[model samples]
Target: MKKIVLIIALLSPLFTYAQNKPNKKKGPTTYDLLIGTYTSGTSKGIAVYRFYAENGRLAYLSQIDGVTNPSYLTLSSNNKFIYAVNETPKGEVSSFSFEPKTGKISFINKQSSEGDDPCYVGVDKAQKNVFVANYSSGTVAVLPVNKDGSLSKAIQTLHDDGAHGPNKDRQEGPHAHMSILSPDEKYLLYNDLGTDKVNVLRYRASNEKPLEPASTPFVSVKPGDGPRHLEFSADKKHAYLITEMGSNVLVFDYDNGKLKQKQTITLLADNFKGQTAGAALHLSPDGRFLYASNRLETNEIIVYAVNQETGELTFVQRQPSMGKNPRDFAIDPTGKFMIVANQNSDTIYVLRIDNATGKLSPTGSRLEIGNPVCLKFAPAQ
Candidate 1:
């Protein structure tokens, strides 16, 4: 009996110590938040904040100025560099070297977009090339990335050759909205809103002029859909597209740079006839749910459950973004929260994501900035 008591006493302290030890999970608790804005309003340039994963919150850390109308941002695969499109009458693409630890960016250089009103920017995984979608000019331009993180003159420029979309007001000319890379980075999806087409371009990172038309060429959406952002599934088996004028989503079965239409889902109610312009679409971190944002009269985010096997999207929930003009929103790496960037409201709302049902609830967390059109996340210590 005494021996048993002694053994229990010895093990009690060890058990208590083990229980009190901190969790050693491999997930990061915080990430660096990079925000791009139109300098015409309250913002002067790009902004950075530390995003807390445990609780949905943001702490301002650093910012850099002098770059005008940084309406969109894309970070390198390594997160060491950032490229932004200067959305101006005279379009330009700017480059910056990023310090993730400090959330600080140093201006590198800039180059003409070879077209007007550059809006979307994308960088290759090898960090060798930068692609910009000149929105007004309806052209896609590619520039080489220098060793020092600067941007060289455009090497290749391709114009969208198609008749204007049906919408005479917004589709008078070709507008390349976004440039999204394939999951394997073998192809580039050029989304032209004015032409209502997603052009597939072969991406050869090692070549001087990398973007050539793919074998499949392009995928045409509804005449007035105004295709905007397109996101690929993590497995590369499916793709989702958001249409601005149509206020709907189109699903595609993706195989080797070829996309076959599968399902089409509308983000609107049966009789709701208010003005709406879809802006951004992104899959959840787990790829189990897809979220699309819209602006104008309907300022809300629509959540849909992704059918894993079929790549079909079923409506899950639709919630107001709690502000106006929710242009871009990002899901955190932990999959616990989503921050909606409302451009006209100058507010970004952090909403709690329901993991089980893919519903979003207000967390009472918000950040106010001027003309925040883009939000991006990167790893931080």
Candidate 2:
């Protein structure tokens, strides 16, 4: 009887883990998520958390200290290293080696971003280089990765020469908002808010200098659409982009390793329209749904049913973020849940997905932090 009891206890967790896997009938994948936050004003660093998709619960894991304003995080393809954007208007990018066992991060190294206020960072498809978008200076930089997954000094930075829009206050200077890796890793796409164009660059194997634009910077949304971030489809045939200043989503036709605009749709609530409200856009892992967040007038996520063939979007549903000013949010690896970091309310909220309808429901688990800006997840062994 004692042996049987021990055996059952040992197998119980396995059972739970099995249950966390995808249920085809239910249509959602259970995910384990690790999130990093912007600890501004108080700590000026990053915070990590473990989100369990099965129960919609977030477990506080570990943190890295002495780092200032670690705002955006990018995990390597092998999940061995984490690259973060330190929002020091005059700051640098920091790298941390990931310990899968404890979900902890050890500082690896830091390098000048080649410009000031780097708000975004991305690892290339080859995982040999890092790209940063510096907002204040309107520049995009490329840094090489060291052998041990640490960082080498930034070798190149590009200052955007152009400006756009009629509004003097918002369009006064160039603001490079995000740096993203194309699926093939052949090109680096930098979304510039100030210029309303996606700065494109070709990555060369042998780099004397890696900072020049590949072709001309690809023009995205119309002037003042202000594209902020972009995500490619799983098949790499289409791209979905979001505009922060204009509150719109633009679909693009992608082929021959290039992106061309297809359609643009509004991401605002019908009854409430005053100013731009959209912030971030992400596609489901299955590539069947697209989720976008709105901040200014209403704090909620707008869901769209995606047509996989043409990359078009149809309205699905909208769910309140359950917190204020969701500056950024991330979907878990398993695709079962989404965690939103509310910057204004200083809390993180968990939401459960209804797979059939593609809607979100509050999970009632919330963590309070100061200026939670970015979130990511690492695996738990």
Among all candidates shown, the one with the greatest lDDT: 1
Query: For residue 355, what is the lDDT in candidate 1?
Result: 88
Clash pairs, model 2 backbone: 34-376, 34-377
TM-scores for all candidates: the values are 0.94, 0.89
C-alpha lDDT of all candidate models, in order: 0.92, 0.79
After aligning candidate 2 to the native by TM-score, how far in Å is the CA of 102 from where it should be?
0.4
Superposing every Cα of model 2 onto the true structure, what RMSD results? 6.6
Tens-digit lDDT string for candidate 1 (1-381): 999999999999999999998889768879999999999988999999999999988999999988899999999988899999999999999999999999989998899999999999998888888899998899999999988889999999999776688889889879998888898889999989998899999999988788899999999998999999999998889999999889999999999899999899998877998999989998888999999998898899999999989999999898999999999999999999999999999999999999899999999999999998999999995
Per-residue alpha-carbon lDDT of candidate 2 for residues 88-155, written as tens digits (9 for 90 to 100): 86869999888766777889889999888888899875677898999889888889998788899887
Q: By TM-score, how accurate is candidate 1?
A: 0.94
Position 41, candidate 1: lDDT = 85
Determine which window of 10 residues in candidate 1 has minimal summed lDDT.
160-169
CA deviation > 4 Å runs, candidate 1: 1-25
Measure candidate 1: CA RMSD.
2.5
Give the C-alpha lDDT of model 2.
0.79
Error of 2 at 340 (Å): 1.0
What does the lDDT read for residue 8 in candidate 1? 99
